[model samples]
Target: MKHIDVKEIISSKEFIGQEITICGWVRTSRNSKSVAFVEVNDGTSLKNVQVVVEKGESDYKEPRVGMALKVTGTVVEGRNNTVEINAVPEGITVLGDAPTDYPLQKKGHTLEFLRTIPHLRGRTNTFNAVWRVRSVLAAAIHEYFQTHNYVYVNTPLITGSDCEGAGEMFQVTTIGYSNDYKNEEDYYTNDFFGRKAGLSVSGQLEGEMAATAMGKIYTFGPSFRAENSNTPKHLAEFWHVEPEVAFAELNDVIEIAEDMLKHVIRTLLDKCPDEVAFFDAHFEKGLRARLEELISHDFGRVTYTEAIELLKNSGENFVYPVEWGCDLQTEHERYLSEKVFKKAVFVTDYPKEIKSFYMKQNPDGKTVAAVDLLVPGVGEIIGGSEREADYDKLIAAMNERNMNLDLYSDYLDLRKFGTVPHGGFGLGFERLIMYTTGMANIRDVILFPRTVGSIR
Candidate 1:
């Protein structure tokens, strides 16, 4: 007997009256005198297949909730044109048994409680919906880039350079420290890779090198950070979707970012309507409407200087001071997107000191062409900059910050030999999923989320 999926049986009505074998875990089971009704799910879809097992039909005892089962049955039409299975006596097998202490039962579970058991949470309806949506979102990201002729490059996981220049990075080391150990700094000279290396925080630098040769390229991979923030918005390890384009400026990067966001949202709405509907009903009311508005309306665009002016005159008491050079806080970004624009907005031309050294310097030598895209609920989902293609200015920016020139010689070489006007942006993949699914915390979207004081 050929095995059939629950989704196939539920979605295809032609399978009615056909004999089939199905394998799934019991979601809920109830036994009557004549027959036993079991709701079985195979993780193929949110809906489960209803199986009717008559008395003396199976060799084993009554199946309990969470028991893995395989049964041979005949499919018949249920009420409202749905299809169900009628299990035969000789074809039922209990693949695994669930003990009485099984954590997940037939009751509602709190999200906080689910976090404790990350391994088994995926079986629940809420997490099943979340992970399915996450899978679709990931596929949509690759589709958007691939259809645009962007070569997918797998960037290195370990690197010796810091792309963001922020010192908050996790270091990779193999040397053990002890009282007898000497020359602690020099020990790295003989360690793995022959020099200091750490997990990559962003693939932008390498992605740019490939883009200069391939015209357009993207990287979808995991990046690590060592920040100690325990907020719902931060994660120690997460995925990033970074795309680089050759000969593109700030405006060009902004257009690409906007288009990509819309494409992913549209794909999610079309592909996973059931999953998206679940989030819309429970997590955030009017989520579908908000997504519809975002794709239809033009994203608001403003400069960092103008944003500071607007905030200063609005008479809103902000905890962080609104200044031209100061970095925009989460509160500021939310205000711009939620209160002022009421949609996604791009704030560009940030102060050079506040941004990375690679951003192109404006003619005034004060601000760089750095841009951040802030959405209605999440602040700053995408960040990009028109790079400093001019080799001299690039070197000067590096020098002002006292960056180690030796470590980034290869990156500097990109500007030296046949460099063009290029730009790119990094999108937080987990945060994007949060926005699409209306998931409040970044940890809830990622599987086995790594945060402060939590490794598993």
Candidate 2:
């Protein structure tokens, strides 16, 4: 009687005896003298249903690809439920007209070729699955946090601070301003906040302050990394879901990260079994198995010292050469997850120099309580650590890293107040999508990946 979504139609077994109205994008079309058949996808189902369109004297041309339209037809199952529309359409309403030269055609397109058309890539099957899975994964994250009683906190983006403070910050600025210059005072005074400010690398710092007082908190939003890595894995701007929890130690944080990852994945697998099956068929052979393994098994965790020893004994020729103090590269991370562990692995107790200042200093004086979660295909999906709760220890560590303590007075104030041992991890949202879908490139997973060379 009334218009229905194509998704609803695909799910309907009750509409067999009646006519119905459906709306969706035109996937494909075939025209005949008296009849036309169309494959329509409403973004409700992975498969498009075939709609039989009989030509009328009104001269209504067949819908083109990328065009949005509404079709009213009778549902008669002569062939299958998918081919129930045997009669001529009563009417068609065009919501939007797509130009003839629309980018997404019915032809096969390579993933590399699609990067250039990122703005419209979501219309593709691969991207649709990726983005849909991505959206679900993010919701799963929020659901996990909220269920765990973690407050959703929005940290200031334009604040005069960079959490990592590694000098890889992109200075927020405005043109045509008097304070915009490389002169003596404007660098700090004339910026967007009337002081130097850049995008946050990790929300952990602010998240920490919130967790200390609020018990548990997480900030899920865009974070910027200025590292000039041009690989398919790295992006300048990406989304990160960082969770900080008070009264949680390094081991506790490690377990929390693993559990959170497994929870999101299991939720997706349960809810989107069809999409998971799509991934299992088209994306990777071990897609289902990999998801199962992550949920079924405990993540392998080895300290930095033990990992280095394992790396040396791993007998595999490493390009960067494994050392005790050096940071682990992506290759090494992959080796641990793909080869040694055969699942997600947490490499912890990284050298103090290689990690952020917040990680608790181990008694060894060489390593901090930092852990990185490495999945089978994606190198590093998460990075987190236990914070140094001792006020003197935090101040000493900050000074050792040459970080300004003044800018971090509020962060340190968490320690000044009643400080309990706390820690958390940041899950890279894009990398998680890459890990889940078996998509190789970070750019392919993100809607529009921001890389070193390409801004648009």
lDDT of 2 by residue, 1-456 (tens): 367766666666677767778777888888888888787777766767678877767575878888887777777665553445544655667888999899886668888888888887777777778877988999999999999999999986655666876777666766445544678466556555666667777777888888877999999999888898898888999998989899999888988898888899999998777778888888798798888987898888888888889899999998999988888888899998889889888888889988888789999898888988888777788888888999999889888878877788888888877989999988888888888888878888888889998977
lDDT for model 1: 0.90
User: Each model's TM-score, in the order given?
Assistant: 0.96, 0.94
Q: Tens digits of per-residue lDDT for model 1 on 232-298?
A: 9899999999999998999999999999999999999998988888999989998988888889988
**True-structure Cα RMSD, model 1:** 1.6
**Decoy 2 TM-score against native:** 0.94
Please tell me which predicted candidate would have the highest TM-score against the true structure.
1
